[model samples]
Target: MENKTNNYSYLRFAQEGKECIYDLFDAFLKKTIIEDRAIDFSKSMTVGDDGSIEFVTLEKDGAEVAFSELVGGDPSYKSVFELYLRRKACKAKDQLTARLALACAHLHWLWSLGMDCKTSCGMYGEAISVEEHWMDSLEDYNRESGLWHVNLSEAGVKQDLTLVFAIFHRFVTWPTRPQFKSVNQVKTALVEFVFKSKKNSGAPVRNGLLHLCDPDKYINWYSFESKTMFVTFHSEYLRGYKVSDYSELLAQDSLYYTRKYPKGMKLDPYQANRTEEKICYIFDRMEDNMPA
Candidate 1:
């Protein structure tokens, strides 16, 4: 039994060492190719207004160079090589293998964009893990050690699966406030915000403002104005309107029904105020409608 255990350990160590060596060699070869092709990649050529390159003819079999074909390649290759380096540096035997895989995938995207893969820089943010509990539903795993272990009991696996679904649902439903100038821009921003926020927050929760509108839809502006006060609803939907249909109404005409309350409307035995009296009446009505 002792000899068998020692043989198994030796085999595992050999396999891991071989994988590490192959990865290192692959990284080294890519770096060499990029360095060798550095100079010819930096040449810039002028492009004409007709989207044509003056001296260069791009051939997909045979074609002319266009304005869009004028990018330098050296920086692009260098960026990709650096990305590989960053990914390799982040991987560790003690860390969750699934998380490391996710980090590697993120590095691929960063490499394509010439960006570096990096950890989040704020409180309560955790790096994404790709282990079976987070990646697959068939395994039980502990995150405390940062490594994913497989072959979990049926009950343990079920609990982990439930936790995963709950997290994903909460992430999808989180609200994103509008912070862009146009409604469409705001929608895209919200989608990105929700994705990042959900990844940061371990458990998914509904976003407070997720029901506002479809991100792809256009919104019209609406405003309400009285003589002394202007209350802009931006749109009827924002004001809790559910009818789904409304005709165009001019802002100036919409203010016609608003009564011209005095600017200094007050309530006292010495002063008479209709607006204050109406407001008080509305509050009393609201209080009366409250459930015990």
Candidate 2:
């Protein structure tokens, strides 16, 4: 059962984790606005001393209705908002389910090869490993231990799958968790746990698992360049970034890929390519294709 209000309440918060009037307005605007029409904020809006959007009035057809009144009277806005929330929740659920399936299969593949975490970590990028770089590891695991061939009979694999489920479950239910004030807080803890020590032997394993959970947010951490880029440039990306904003961007990206690519042509049939890598690849291609 999904709490539909999870995204609704989260959209109310600004980047600093404080609720913001503009953010709330933006949420409605995003869902309900017509592309061709623009609200003239100069006359139709009011700002408070605290920098909040104090009031709004929308004008159309030579008439004006108070935005607050429209919101109060219109059930359509509520319907649209709820619809959007359901779509977001559905996408999130799908992402989690597919990732969990892959994780279970990956763990089974490792166990079948008589590999513990230690052996898998040591054999990163090797032929007989599922702990390799992001792209190939997923391919290998999906090819070898797909749900059809996955073995849950092994006690060790079952134990590891339980732990994986717990970690992934924390993220799925994080919206209602009191300790995590926002997704950013949960993401911060994830970053610390996943990439805490670069030299740690389990770095590859940690990276692969986290990436499996959320490719849009988590980078493939085994590569040195990925770590360097994250350390150097991730903060710049975070400027003015809210958890809600991140979610919306993901929705946009997902939509773009869905419209542009056929199912089999996608980079990873299971999930989106890691966002960091895609951005860097775009930059490199732009440079290479430049007309000198």
- Give per-candidate clash totals: 9, 0
What TM-scores do the predictions have?
A: 0.15, 0.22
Tens digits of lDDT, candidate 1, 89-135? 44434434322333233222212111111111111012332221111
Candidate 1, after superposition: displacement of residue 38 in Å? 28
Determine the backbone clash count of candidate 1: 9
| Candidate 2 vs. true structure, TM-score | 0.22
lDDT tens digits, residue span 1-292, model 2: 1111123232211122112212222322332221212222223234334433322333456765322222222334334322432341322235333323333333333333322222121211222222333212111122222111222343334333333333333333335433544434444554433332222132234444443323344443433334444434534444333343466545645432211224554232211233444444444454566899
Candidate 2 C-alpha RMSD relative to the actual structure: 22.8
lDDT (CA) per prediction: 0.24, 0.32
Candidate 2: list runs displaced more than 4 Å. Answer: 1-178, 182-184, 197-199, 210-214, 217-292
